[model samples]
Target: MLILTWVFVVTAGLALAYAAASAIGAWRWSVAARNLVAELTAGRVAPAASRHHAAELAGLPAPVQRYFRAALTDGQPIVTAVSLTQSGLFNMSAVADQWKPFTATQAFATARPGFVWDANITLFPGVPVRVVDAFVAGEGLLRPTILGLYGLGTLQGTGEIARGELLRHFAESVWFPTALLPSQGVVWQAVDDTSANATMTDGPISVTMLFRFGVDDLITSVSVEGRATTVGTATVLMPWECRMSNYQTRDGMRVPLTGEALYITPQGEKPYFKGTIDTIVYEFAP
Candidate 1:
């Protein structure tokens, strides 16, 4: 009976130590994330014209114009920054369907097109993986950690990773529709009645995406060819796509509440990230 009591005490002490470590690690990570977000939003200034108007849509592609008309209202304030919370499933396997549930909070700065996404994925009960995917100062960063302490891997570079992160920023612009407008550096070209090509450039990186629109004038999907993806230890360019749905009005603007990202491999479409937005708060230009 004494031995059993000792074992219980030891186990309880170990569990308490682990919980304390995780709490400290999470606090440190949160501090770092706030610093990164500050860097992303620094030097941003309000646009000369901070409100949307129908006149701004002229000369854009037909589909692009329709999308703006449906997504933004006249005199609507342009979004300068955004923060949102999300919950959903993240696929852990590259070739198989091993999905884990996750919760995330993201912040975006539209003036220079940057974002930081902080997420926690539950590997199993009581075990969580923390990840931060960000694009700031023309550099892309992907950092994943177990319990916010031990990093599993870190990916950052100037070429493919940077380009890929920028592409992600541009593709996800639908949530902040005004960022896709001409005044915001997006160049739209008509692809068809239902599709258009939108290109954006930031410093040394430039990307183009094909946006498909539904009859309601909302974005159906955004696709690009030659996005860099890691296979084993090598990096390769592959076709990638993001689909948006469940449009709802928020802060006088229409935005998608659910989204999914996938890679179009030679075999077929392999979806990896699927998320639903829980709440969104916007900081409009003054």
Candidate 2:
């Protein structure tokens, strides 16, 4: 009786396993179709979805359909204003009580070869002042403006911080050479742009990204929690928080300028960085 029962259990398990595989396969295939469609859109095969498909997709949820529409649009790199709150450990500014936090604004003008990320900042009190800077993302790069009134000057030769370096030193003390490339894919979930739950792993080291945002996806906050797993040791973890929000769009793209980032070191010391821009109003030349 025992032997017969074992045989039956094994047989049933195989059947269930087969069924599960079939289900997952079907799901993956569906996802593949969408991915293929996305790639096609990226490659300029079809700038707009066929009318029939667009109508069919309209039957889905609004956000999903919005994403679908965005995907179908021709690979005209989106040009929008990015107003980011600039702050960092290097700042000599203070966070006064009942006073506003560190903030700035930037005009994100994007095109093919590169995008010009221009920044403006007002770091003085009682004095209405602004600074401007432009950086090209694809081809033509802009130079960071010099804040004449304030002694704090732009990082001497860093007009265009390479995307590779930006993604690497994102929250790290310094840039890491072996950081994963952008093509790896970025998956982000948020309780708002101010607070987010994210995970990006390259190899042995896994980085946890957390953030806080202003009401309208103005990233008024950011946090990158790090975890280190060693061969024979327990894991090491850390936490920090920053906030930013407020924006001005030059084109149709929305950019968040009022933002902050909180950093905690391995030994547990807190630090903050904020984006600094003076004026940010988007105007489309073309």
Candidate 3:
């Protein structure tokens, strides 16, 4: 009886230590995230009207130029930073499994290609998961915790993951039309009458995406080659695409408020994320 009681005490002590460690880790993560956001916010500058000059649009393809004209006003302020709320369905598995509904709030800084997305994912009755996914200073991190105590998964890296996030930021530029201006990291090359190739570079990472516009001068789809995705335990480069629709004019800019992210594989295209933006607020330097 005494031995059993000692074993129980030891187990309980170990469990308490683990719980304490997890709590500390979570607190540190939150503090670091806040600091990163503050730093990005402090470095921003007000949007310059000169940056969106008509001359800059002269070199772009016709469709690309039309897209800029249709999406952004001539003197509209450039979106340096943005905060948005989104609700979506996220598929956790690739085997045609059920998709879990989620609501997320995100903040993005265009200059550094940094973003923080916090999501609440409902998997079952009374069981929900909190996910914090972020890309800061060329690092990508995804942390999902249950009940704020136990960690479900963590995928973090600086190479492939960071590249993937950079591509993601480029795709999401549709939501922040000013970021797609030629003055930004984006450079456009004519592909055809309705399509253009955009090369976006942030620091050492460079990615090219093909933008296809519809007759209305709205971007209908974006496709990127060599985007990274995780397959089982291996990280592989795959073709990825985002289909945009449901255009809405907000803050004097036309933007796609609904989109889906898909992975194009040899078998077929698998869409893993479908989201609708609820709100988008832009910020500039003071």
Candidate 4:
């Protein structure tokens, strides 16, 4: 009886220590996220008066110009930041064995190219897992915590991960139409009548994406070469694509409300993330 009691005491103490550590880690992460959002908000560039002018599309490819016209009005306010909610199925394995249903909320800042996504995955009847994926100020981080007590996994990096995340932010601009407008650090070149290439440079990171448009002048897909994808324990650079569909108007702008992300593997194309956007709210600098 005494031995059992002693074992119980030790186990309880260990669990307490783990809980305390997890709490501390979560607190630090929350504080860092808040500080990052504030810093980016303050550094946002002021929008130009001619941002929505038709003349601003002069040097852009014709298809790119048409996409702007289809997605935005003559004087839509440029979106500096956006908040959105999404529901989707997130795959847990590369073999497509397990898929978990999830709902997430994301905040994105275009001025500096950063985003914070928080998701809750339903894994069991009474328990849920929380995941956070974010890129801020040239840093990329992914953290998954179970029951707010134990961290399942964490991936944090700066160089390639940061660049890839920046590319992601640029591609996701499909949901924030005004973000694709001609900007100081952004340039568009024609690929063909159905496609264009966009190069976005933010500080030391420069990434380009090929944008494919449909007959209606809406973006159908965005593809990037040498994008990073995690395979096994190693991160591999590969061709990646995001296919958009279900066009709808949100807050006076046409945007894609549904999409999926696929990695073009040597074997074939494998799609991993699928999501439906429920709401999008734009925030502009005053």
Candidate 5:
């Protein structure tokens, strides 16, 4: 009986320690996300334009103008800040396409082009990986941890990482359409009638993507050439694409509720992320 009792106590202690570590990890992530959001908000640039006007769309590409007309109502207030929650499936294996479930919360500052995305991916039944992808003040960060406690990798700096994160911010502008307007540092060029090229520059990095509009005038897909993709310890340039769907009105803006991200690899298209927005909140320019 004493032996059994000791075994039970050891098992219980192990479980308790595991639970404590998990909780602490979660708390650390929360604190990091909060601090990053504060920095992004404080470092935001003052708006050059506050509201959307139909007349301003005349000079943009035809498809871009159509998109804006359908996505925003006249005199719509420009989005300055945004926060959203998302749930999705992320492909874990680069070779096998093993998909894992994930949940994430993201915050964005439009004026200065910054964003922080905090995500937790379930690698196994009880193992979760926390990933924080962010860009601020022309720098980028990508950190991943096991249960938010044991660091797997922490990537940060300028150049490719920064450019990649900026590209992500620009592509995700579909969720907050006001950020894509011509006045918001996005220059649109004609690419046929159903597609357009959007170029956004932040500091020394400039990224461009081809945006395809559907018949309903909603953005169907965004594709870019030569986005930095990390393969092992080395990062390589690869073609990337994000497909969006399930249009819905949120805060008087038409935005995609679902999205999938993929890499155009030599073997063909390899998707890495499939996500749906669970809830979103917007703060417009006053």
Candidate 6:
């Protein structure tokens, strides 16, 4: 009985020690996250100038410097921004080659009123979907101006766009297909990367917005990729890649010049959709 009692005592002590250590680790992680975000925002260009110091920042994952050199570009600030509800058209081969309209709405912000937004998604055209009426929860840069004029036609309960998917895609869409984006504002974030994951048709693929910056420290392009399977087909899988590029300036702010999407199925089917935006009518109304 004494031996069993001693074992129980030892086990309880070890468990308590483990619990304490875990609590301490979580606390440290929280504090580190706070400091990291602070550095990302206020650190800005000054932080960029000090590459050695920038490397020390805990805001981004250590691999961030290697994967995203734009974060350390000259004159570029640690920009956080958003793309509000954008309505577009898309066509898919999974659903009897059905073409439908899609409306994507996101609400975001930054610490400052300045931000550069480059976001795009492929949709079915000739379907003309309308932005009925909607609201964004996180009001970063658009809190005072852009939000009001935009999403004026959004609808209620169509659904709220997930902010996490928005940020993950935001990281990808910022560069490559587009010029680049730079700004000092608030944007969205996600714990997981969704674009690279596998998805099925009729599974209601939540829209993803890829973000990265281009040359001139301005937002150049944005892209969203989605996939699905044929509803009643013989186990056929279709993969799609859509990218929006070509940026134009309206009243000093840059907007995408053209948006393009490509859909590919294992059965040799490629449907293409493209859009040309003539002018951007919105501005940062500070």
Predicted structure with the largest TM-score when compared to the true one: 5
TM-score, prediction 5: 0.97
After the best TM-score superposition of candidate 1, give how far the Cα of residue 101 lies from its true spot, in angstroms. 1.0
What is the clash count of model 3?
A: 0
Is 1 or 2 the stronger prediction by TM-score? 1
Query: Worst lDDT window (10 residues) for model 2?
Result: 173-182
Q: How many steric overlaps are in each model, in order?
A: 0, 48, 0, 0, 0, 44
Model 4 residue runs over 4 Å out of place are: 1-36, 48-50
RMSD to the hidden true structure, all candidates: 1.3, 25.6, 4.5, 3.6, 1.2, 21.3
lDDT of 5 by residue, 197-238 (tens): 999999888998999999999999999988888788888999
Give the alpha carbon lDDT tens digit for every residue of 142-243 in model 4.
777775446886778788888888888889989887777775357898889999999887778888999999999999999988888788888899999999
Candidate closer to the true structure by lDDT (higher is better), 1 or 2? 1
Q: After aligning candidate 1 to the native by TM-score, how far in Å is the CA of 78 from where it should be?
A: 1.1
Q: Judged by lDDT against the true structure, how good is candidate 2? A: 0.34
Better of 1 and 6 by TM-score: 1
- Scored by lDDT, the top model is 5
Q: What C-alpha lDDT, on a 0 to 100 scale, does residue 158 get in candidate 1?
A: 76
Return the number of clashes found in candidate 6. Answer: 44
Q: Lowest-scoring 10 consecutive residues by lDDT in candidate 1?
A: 43-52
lDDT of 3 by residue, 1-286 (tens): 9999999999999988867765775576567557756765665544444346666788789999999989987767667889999998998776575799998888898776678887777877545667877777777777788644568768897888888887888889899888888777588999999999998876777878999999899999999878887788788999999999999999888999999999988889899899999888987544
- Whose lDDT is higher: candidate 2's or candidate 5's? 5
On TM-score, the stronger of 4 and 5 is 5
Clash list (residue pairs), candidate 4: none
What lDDT does candidate 6 reach at residue 125? 30
What is the lDDT of every predicted structure here?
Answer: 0.91, 0.34, 0.82, 0.81, 0.92, 0.34
lDDT of 2 by residue, 1-286 (tens): 9999999999999988766664664455345334433332333212111122344443333333343243333222322222233432233222322223333322232111112222333345432222322223211221222232332333212212232223222332111101111222223443432355444532233345553433333334445444221112332434555544454442333343444544455545444345544444432222
